[model samples]
Target: MPVLLYVLAVAVFAQGTSEFVLAGLVPGISADLGVSLAEAGYLTSGFAVGMVVGAPLTAAVGRRLAPRWTLSACLAVFVLAHVSGALTDSFGVLLGTRFVAALANAGFLAVALSTATRVVPAGRRARALSVLLGGTTLALIAGVPAGALLGELWGWRSALWAIAGLSAAALVAVGRLTPPRTSTDHPGSARPRLDLRAELRTLRSPDLLRHLGLGALVNGATFCAFTYLAVTVTDGAGLVPSLVPLVLALFGLGAFAGVSVAGRLADTRGRLLLDVAGPALLAGWIAWAALADSPAAVWVLAPVQGALSFAVGSTLIARSMAAAQGAPTMGGAFSTVALNLGALLGPVLGGASLGTAGTAGPLIVSTALVAVAVGLRLVTARRRSGAPAR
Candidate 1:
């Protein structure tokens, strides 16, 4: 694997940490900013909205730029946004900064995934992609927890400052490691036609659409449950408030394990089954979690559910990239959008479920959604195999 892959991975790690660490720091931020907890929660929502808007927009704009340069520019934007977020006094300004930061993050991820696959040998491409993507999972496992600890000790602003520093390191690494852009065409050739129409045509395939839909559904369901997981563990399970961050950290650790295992399994066994099976298992785990009343059960079940849900990341991403044919960037961008959509909807749904059906309703709905995703995957897989061989 190229050393550049590792550099890009660092960039991803920084972005992931910045995006998710907020969850652990929400209460601190609310207290420091003099905002209500509900308002502080909008930071997560703002980031999600930015990701959804940025993916396609960045892809469209960066079509003409070299992939390396595009990535570098995105990282620069990310760093600036983080700095702004760290320094801002007003809550509204902080939210705007976070949203822009998320936009840069989404674009960086989409471009980085495309570049990783392109740089590696075809035989090792999936593994290469896994290595790059694993950085984000690692951040979830380690970075968020550490940030929470820092927030508790110093303040939430300190956590944001730390993220900004990390982003700076990532920017420098990316600039040094990535190679100059090379054209797919003849030397000094005019840029190839981007063909937005052709790209849209790719989405018209029934199999591709089904895969995308499955991606969206699985993510939406998973996020819905996960967004409010910390709250559930604290409020419903009756765990001490101080322990919530540690539990969330453990969840991140489970996610890291899940992502690593899932990547290898998808590369070897095929992604479709892994996609369905991971979510199905996650649903069962969530149900178990819902039924448990003890603190021990909460600890055990949270990690289990985290493992099952996150394990499917690589599989789902690889599936979308494969189904996209040659347009890996657009496919990746769309997948990012799906993920953000899930992030946006998950907390809202979970909160509503908590209000309406009490603690168990969200998990029950999540289980049903995962089951539906599994059925959809089965039908899609059979249809693909039954079709004329490509």
Candidate 2:
């Protein structure tokens, strides 16, 4: 584990917190901005959209720049977006800030992942990637909870202010830690030309595309349950509102544990994980839906579900990067887009089930989504082995 990976994780912590903490501040924002809660919720959706758009665009524009500089620029922009968001009086301006901040977040993550793998030994690439992703799971456990508390105590703007300050500190750390130049940045000294045409061609691989789609499905299923987890915890389990954070904490802890364990195995046992995780998740989600009425079961299963979700999610991403090894940086963008696309869709499908299905709706949806992923994986595997597709 390189020290630089931790530094990047810290930066990711600051940015990732921004992605989730908005839910806690929705009430404050809606009241302050004179908008409906539905409207304020769009802030999160806007951020997701921005991330999907920004990853590839930012990667292409910064392809020539050293990653140290790219990461720094991203954190700087992230800081600026938060500062702007904190000071804004208009809801429209705030929405725009969310979009801008997500762009920064997307670019930072894509570059940070690529850089982490490059700096580490090849054998540890998966572990290195997980360490970077740990920051995200950590954000869920500690950072978002803290930010929501800040919003509760001081107001929504205060949460943004805290995020901005935290992000600024991370910016300084990134600037200090990452290498200022790679060989690619060197002028006229055996700089391998990365032909855009060649890279684009690599994206067309069926295997790579399958990995991307599978990654999306895994993420979609995770988000399907996760987005509405609070509802399930509160309304279904009959837990007090205050306990929601504790449940979320359990989920995050499980996610962190999952990522750590999966990271270590992703390089060596990735195939095994891929083969096993889907069925595990399918069972987990089905059990979750069946047991939604049991408070004890819900409590016990939160961590289990979290662990399964991140393990499978991380494995799929590792596989995607492995497949996209031809253009590793662009691979980062593709992975980000796939994962965020899932993030965006998961909530929509889950939300749809809420009206008629109640608390179990999202869980059932989650089960179905992962089932599709499992089927796809099996089909793709058979095809690769020269078996006819079912």
TM-score per prediction, in order, is 0.90, 0.96
RMSD of each candidate relative to the true structure: 3.1, 2.5
Model 1 stretches with alpha carbons more than 4 Å out: 182-194, 271-276, 279-283, 294-296, 382-390
lDDT (Cα atoms) of all candidates against the true structure: 0.74, 0.86
* Alpha-carbon lDDT of model 1: 0.74
Q: Report the C-alpha displacement of residue 351, candidate 2, in angstroms.
A: 0.7
Worst 10 residues of 2 by lDDT: 182-191
Error of 2 at 376 (Å): 0.6
Residue pairs in candidate 1 whose N, alpha carbon or C atoms collide under 3 angstroms: 224-346
lDDT of 2 by residue, 38-112 (tens): 999999999999999988888778877888888899899999999999998999999999999999899888888
lDDT of 1 at 128: 71
Which parts of model 2 are misplaced by more than 4 Å? 184-193, 386-390
Candidate 1 lDDT by residue in tens digits, 199-315: 767788765666566667667776776766766677777888888767777877777777767766665665554745655665565665567456777777777767777666566
lDDT of 1 at 90: 91
Cα RMSD, model 2: 2.5
Candidate that would win on TM-score: 2
